[model samples]
Target chain A: MSSNLILLVSLLAGLLLGFFTKPAANRARLANRLLMATILVLIFMMGARLGLMPDLGERILAYGRAAIVITISALIFSIIAVRILVWLFMRKRGGEL
Target chain B: MMLLAIISCLLLGLGAAYIGLMPPEVAVFVNEAPFYCLCAMLFIVGYGMGQDKNTLRGLFKENAFVFLVPVGTIIGTLVGGLLAGLILPLGIRESMAVAGGFGWYTYSAVYLAEMHSADLGAIAFLSNVSREMLAIILIPAVVRFFGAYPAVSICGATSMDVTLPLLAHYAGSKIGAAAFLHGAVLSFVTPLLLPLLIGF
Candidate 1:
């Protein structure tokens, strides 16, 4: 009954169903819209919960700093690694592909 | 547009709660809604993955270089997390857990909230969301300057869905399959990686 367990179960179920059904374009579109709505609701709920916390301002400031730092580092490192890989692997192919 | 909507929704919820508009009865629903909503979102994500037979099949047969994009992303993001740990106040494991989300913010945040503290979960959420925002801004520039691989890899798990169109537009349609496969691979790894990092 854990959240992760719930997530895994739901994902597996959907994967199996979609794999078998191979839903048509219309149904797939509907699912995408539904997914967007669900994500928005989840984000809203997350925000509301955080908003209800006592030290919201201070926590956001502290967490926001970490968020920005981690994001930049992740981007920098990813670009470096991928750049090296591309040069090693794709340079022979030539052109900006 | 999607990012705009996401931020707007978050702000609206924050504003709603800040203004004391949430009554006691509604607060009960707000407390529990994320669980169900997250389940739904993951289900849809899985379904999309299942539907994309080409991306999965291509993973096995495509030029091995395409696979390297996600590999680079995983390596770089975790290393960045480790480095951030050294400087920031957070421990290595916690910093890695936050980075390990790999841009799948909803699942990581919710999982950490349940397993650790809500504060850590919030940090994960903000960090991953910020990564997505950064990806949106950087994708075009990265494609123009760095190359398609970095541009696609920079998107983390969002390359397939949220940023696919942009990737296609900027990086060109030739790179679309590689980009989708890159995102799909990262998305698959995130759920497995986060729990191990947090639980350890």
Candidate 2:
């Protein structure tokens, strides 16, 4: 199966299981802890993979710069758009200021 | 602290690889590890969402219009991605795909790596991680100054989890609820968007 399909399937399976089982709070917390550890391991593996890439230094530098640029732009634009939404919302509510 | 730990983990792995600490036999496992991790993470996230029972249902019920915030976030972030694409070396689609991550770094990184270039995937990871870190830092100030919507908007998908408490404490429970709704919607949609956009 495709990766995305795998993701969706796993997610739906988990959702169904959790919904039916209604695991205790402690179990949920343990699940969360396990998730965090898994995430860290994933990141570590990503780093290792990147490290093994050719021209590792240059790639990191370039990717880092692009990352910063993309992040800042996304943040600014999302804020602006939401601000407009807020303004429109207030106006639609008959200017309840 | 979580951010620091994530970074530390990344660095540690990089350092380990840099020094050839892992045997060649282990490289295969390390390479395949992210896919499993992504699946595990998604399952856990889905389970959490299932357990909550409120976020998806609440979106349609109370304050239904709050859904617009996420709409705004999606459009604005895509626009930003387009502009960034123009400014940067990446293609417009590539840039938008990266932006479509919406601060969910883990999935974005792994998905992009498998579907697209590993480099692009790495960029998605770094960019989304930075986005989350920036949101965490800016949220309180944004709430106090710009108001609640902007504060929540800054968090992207993370408003549902990583930054929800901060939004609640600073912006109040009402905005907190909106933030959760915003995040839940975004989280559901981002995976769909990333693949569609990155196809180019």
Candidate 2 chain B lowest-lDDT run of ten: B55-64
Classified by CAPRI criteria, candidate 1 counts as medium
* lDDT tens digits, residue span B1-200, model 2: 77788889888878888788867877788777777788888888778777877556765677756878899899999999999999999888999999999999977887788678789989999999999999989988988777788888889999998999998888887776788878877887886787689763
- The fraction of reference A/B contacts recovered in model 1 reads 0.71
- For model 1, residues B114-156, the per-residue Cα lDDT tens digits are 5677788888989999888889888889988998889988889
TM-score of each: 0.91, 0.92
Off by over 4 Å in 2: A92-97, B55-60
Q: What is the DockQ of candidate 2?
A: 0.65
Q: Local distance difference test, per candidate?
A: 0.82, 0.84
In model 1, the clashing pairs are none
